[model samples]
Structure formats: C-alpha cells, structure tokens
Target: MSNRWCAVVRCFVVGPIGNKFAPLGDPGRQSYEDSLQVFEEVIQAACQQVGIDPVRADQIAVAGEITEQVFRHLFEDDVVIADVSGGNPNVMYELGLRHATGKLTIQIGEFGQLPFDVNTVRTIQFSRSPRGLIDARNQLERALQAGLLDGQDVLTATRIFQESGEGKAEIDLPLPEPSIEVDGSDDEPGFLDNMIEIENQLALMTDNADGVASSIEVIGAVTESVGAELERAAQSGASNSARLALISKYASEISEPVEMLEKSSADFASNMTSINDGVLSVLGVIQNGDPSELPEGWDGFLDQLIGMAESSREGMEGLNTFGTAAEGLGSLSRQLRGPGRKINNSVGNMRKAIAKIDAWERAARSIKHKAANNPVG
Candidate 1:
C-alpha cells in the first residue's frame, strides 16, 4: 500500500466551491482559512499518531494532471482524511470516490456546517480555537490509531449506505485451489512444526479475545454515561430545545467507541474460528499419526489446547457481563420511554441506541456459544 497521506478540500475562500454550500465570509477570507487550518492541524496530528509522514496535494510532486493525482491518492493511500466543512463540492465528490472503493477515510468538519447528504454520516466536528483543536486532535488520533491496528480498511461510507437501505456494492471473490499440502513429504510441514504454528495462532486468538472483552466493558460504561446524560436532560431540559439538541449530540458521540468495539469483536470471533479449526486439525494428525515424534507430554500440544479452552471460558464470561449490561439498557429504556416520562420525546433516538446495544449483546452470546460447543483440543 502507498504511504501517501491525502487531504481532499478546495481553496479556502468566501464563496462555495460549486454552488453546493451557502455563501460564507460575511467575515471574509480569514474565516475560511482559519477553519481550514483546524482541518490541517488535525490531519497532521492524526498522521503522526499513526506513524505516517503527513503529505498534502501541493507538497508531493505529480507528473500527471492534478485531478489524476487526487484520484490516485484517494484509491491508493492507506488513509485519506477529508474536510467537508462548507460542503465543498470537490471534497464531497472525492469522498464519494473513496466511498465507492470502500476504502479507509476519516472525515471532519466545522460543527453544524454540513448539509444533509453528509450530515447523517458520522463526522468529527471541531472549532477554530486552540482548545477545540486539541480536542479534535485527541479524538481523531485515537480513531486513526485504532484503524491502523485493525488490519482491515474501515469502510464508513459503505456502512452508512447500507444502513440507509441503499443498494450495496456487490463483492465477489473467485475461489482457488487449496494451498496447504498434507502429503507427509519432507517438504510438507512435520508434526512438531505444525504443532508449533497452531500454538502461536492460539496465543494470538487469546490475546484478541481479551481485547474484545475489554472493549465490551467500554461499551457498558459508555452506555451508562448516555443513560445519565438522558436523565439529566429529562430532569432539567425536557421543554428546552437546546438541551434536547445537546442530548442528541452526546448520543452521536458514543457511536465512535461503540463502532470500534463492534469491529474488534467481529475480528476476534473470526480469529477464534480459524484457530479452532487449525488446532483440531493438528490434534487429528497427532492422534492418527506417530505420537513418538512429539516429545514428552505431547510436546506442549495439550497445554495449548487447555489454554485455548480457558480463553474461551473467559470470553463467555465477558459475554455474560455484556448481557447484564444489556439488561440495564432495557431497564433504562423503560424509564425513558415508559408512561409520563419527561424525556419521552427523546425515546425514539434512545431506542435506536438501545437496539445497537442489543445487537452487540446477541453477537457476543453467539460467539460464546459457538466456542463452548466446539472441542478445544
């Protein structure tokens, strides 16, 4: 993958780029430039956080047309940060290109400046002040670091499209012949070698499982925080529109952490399935073939199996904790949506959030059940 860092935006000016956004700069060019600088600073901070040298369109040499370079970066770069403030037509168009490819893209904009097309999608918002810049940097930095380590491209726009019930991009992968050889030749992997490999895989799965469990705890905490905020709004601002708006913003804020946890948990489950199959295959070989090749105590094979079983047990415990948290969500929902509640107006959005929590709980339970029913060794 190319290490190119890309930022998609237009020239900072008073008027909209392509009749897309309302005219700005009743305050003039400085206002435009100030907002763009906030975008630039956050991008640089995020790049540094993820260990990528920051590069912009003008900073890099290009042998082709400017549009060509822009498209290439959007498609080829590991990450492309887009600024959607003022709904710049060029930036929005390029973001659509990135979305079509379902590539990794980070979006930020000035608060409340985005149009409806991009508004429903998640976008980090920042102000043009020093404190706001620092907050924006920290928030984007955490998100970028997580994406860098996830080992998968985060297709945010694709998710938004699917969630909106729009048509999905069809994905098709052609299958190939099996690459693993089990002919028992010297060229093929021997018993001890395969055992060692499976052992390593088991360890990685266990670590990933731990990460998932920790993330679930974070989910529970964030959910409770949301509950508290809603209660506050109900008590003091049930009739206040501004308070209701603040409540909506806080609900959106938790989506980032929730999304991060969901991604990590899904990856954890996939790894567990692969590791389970691999360990069982190795166990079959050991039981059927010569056991003499293995050293004393089956050369740590049984230990690895036991470790995997213990890890699966821990994963189940985490799921149970998540279920308990889900119960809390149901209780909280009753209070928020039940009869005579002041926050009844906010119940619709809160239910959407609760549904997300419920889905996560079920996923955790399913993974735990699969692990429990399967043989560890």
Candidate 2:
C-alpha cells in the first residue's frame, strides 16, 4: 500500500517462451519471439503499474545455483505471476511450487490454451492483439493490486489442501524440542514438566489471540472511518485523484494493524498446534492405559487439561469476535474493491485459525472426558 513496501516488493514471472499453438480459431501458432513480446507488453507492464519489479526465469542473470535461486524466488518472493498459456512442463512445475507456498500468485493464459487442471484457477486471458493485450494488462494490474494488498486473497494449492478437510492442516513452523527427554530414566520428567510447557505455550497463544482481536478492533474502527470519508468525498463530487488519495491514506493507516493480525494469527495457530500435539500425545497415553497407570501428577494433569480447554475456548471466542469484525470491514468497503478484497482475504485466514483452535479445544476436552470416565481399577 505504501511506496516503501512497493519499493521492495519482489516478483517473479514464469511462463513458456518456446513456440506453441495459439487458440483454436485465432492463429495456428505463436512464435517464441511473440511470447516475449506479450510478456513485455502485457505482464511486465502490469507488474510495473503495481510497483512490482518482475524478473522472468529466463531473464535471471545470476550465476550461483541458478536452480536454487529460481526455487528460492518462487518460494519466498512476495508475488509470482505464472503464465500457463502453453502448459509448458517447466512453467507448470514452477507454478506448482509457488502454489504450495500459498503466497500471492496471479495466473494468466490464452483463452483456449489453458490446461484442463489449471483452467479451474482464475486466470487472466490475453491474445496478441493490441486491444487484447490492453485488457489483459488492466486485469493483471487489478489482480496484482488486490493480491499485493492482501495475499490471503489468492487460493493457492496450499490453501486448497488446508481447507479440503481431508486432514488437519498444519502450517510449517520450527517446533521446539520435546519437553521430556527420551532417555528412559525413572527420574525423567513426566506430566508436570510437559504440562508446564503446555501451559507456557497456551499463555503465548492466548496473548497472540488477544493481540489479534485488539488489532482487528482497531482495523474495524479505522475502516469505518475511512469508508465514511470516501463516501463523503464522493457525495461532494471529489476528483478521482482525491478519492484515490483517501484510499491510499486508508491503506497506510490500516497496514500496520493488518500486518499485526496476520502475524499474531499465524503465531496463535502455530502455538495452538504445538500444544495440541502435546495434549493429543498425552490423551493417547491416557486412553490406552488404565487410569491407575497415569503417573504421579494424574489429578493435576486432568486439572491442567481442563484449564487449557477453558483458555482455548476463550481464545476462540476472541478470534470469532475478530473474524466477525473483519467480515464486517469487508462488507463495509465492498464498494471500494481493493480494500474489500484485502479484508475478505484476511477473514479467510482468521477462519483457518479459528478452526485450528477449535480442534485443539476439542482434543483437550476429550482428554478430560476420557480421564473422567476411565476410572482407575
């Protein structure tokens, strides 16, 4: 949203550069040189409009570990534009890599040349004609603007997997070492130490959850105020540039809070998963063994589980509040396309966090229930 963020936004473009058949009725084939022209005219121009410096894979001038460099950029860059026109194997492979990261990615292709699997994804279609390229460039610019504003808007392969419900989704994080040592000593720490670790993690997660809620509250208030400003400006017949300035100011004001929500929600989810795994591990032991087999801190373990469950529930409630507020922000600015889409994307992320914490709470409660029902012999 700010020129500062724009100055550093890195983008990579991956697509086929070799000659290939054009759409069915338009042209029989397109040359490699023509493809380059399309990139220069359409994709790169759109990227520049959005303040992104796009570097195509072929244009990479670096010498060291070129493959690694390519992969790294695909994985870590702020934005990726994949042209799937020819379904080129190399381009597809690189696009898949970008998809897996769940970052901001934009797809573009010729109308009929899109691969069957990729056709489902929303892609900007362009032809080689002057008018066609203009339309594509405009669409690409909007897509880039929206995506750069809110990365969560793009449903990459990673998001599909996470939302699929086939399995519990896990975001990659560097998890800490297990609290209990595996050296099988009778003196090795048991439930107390692990429970303490769980408590600490839960505290961090709760803090982060609260942080997210507070940030979202700020965002909601600011969004409403900005929306009102925009509406007033429109009612008074403000110039387009003036309206744009208001929008840009709004973006600048909310950027920090939005970033906070993003980071805190992610941290909250990671901490929840870490503690959830610990709880599940303990739950498994409780379910499989006689209650009498529970170690010295049996009662304390159940009590702690109950407390964790309560804390998790509270966290979820806060997150749900923020989620609703975020959704409202999206709706409030629906007329303003860019901000609305950005807020909506953030709602998706909030939903993911809520779902994870919900599962974590369930596991904690189940552990408590099993302990209560499975009495010692």
Which 10 residues in a row give candidate 1 its minimum summed lDDT? 7-16
Off by over 4 Å in 2: 1-188, 289-353, 370-377
Over 257-359, each residue of candidate 2 has an lDDT whose tens digit, in order, gives 8777777767776776666667655545554455565566645655655554445444444444455555554433434444444544545555555554434
Off by over 4 Å in 1: 1-32, 151-377
The top-ranked prediction according to TM-score is 2
For residues 300-341, write the lDDT of model 1, one tens digit per residue.
555445444444434444444444344443343333222212
Give per-residue lDDT, candidate 1, residue 63: 32
Instruction: Report the Cα lDDT for residue 108, model 1.
Output: 79
Clashes, model 1: 0
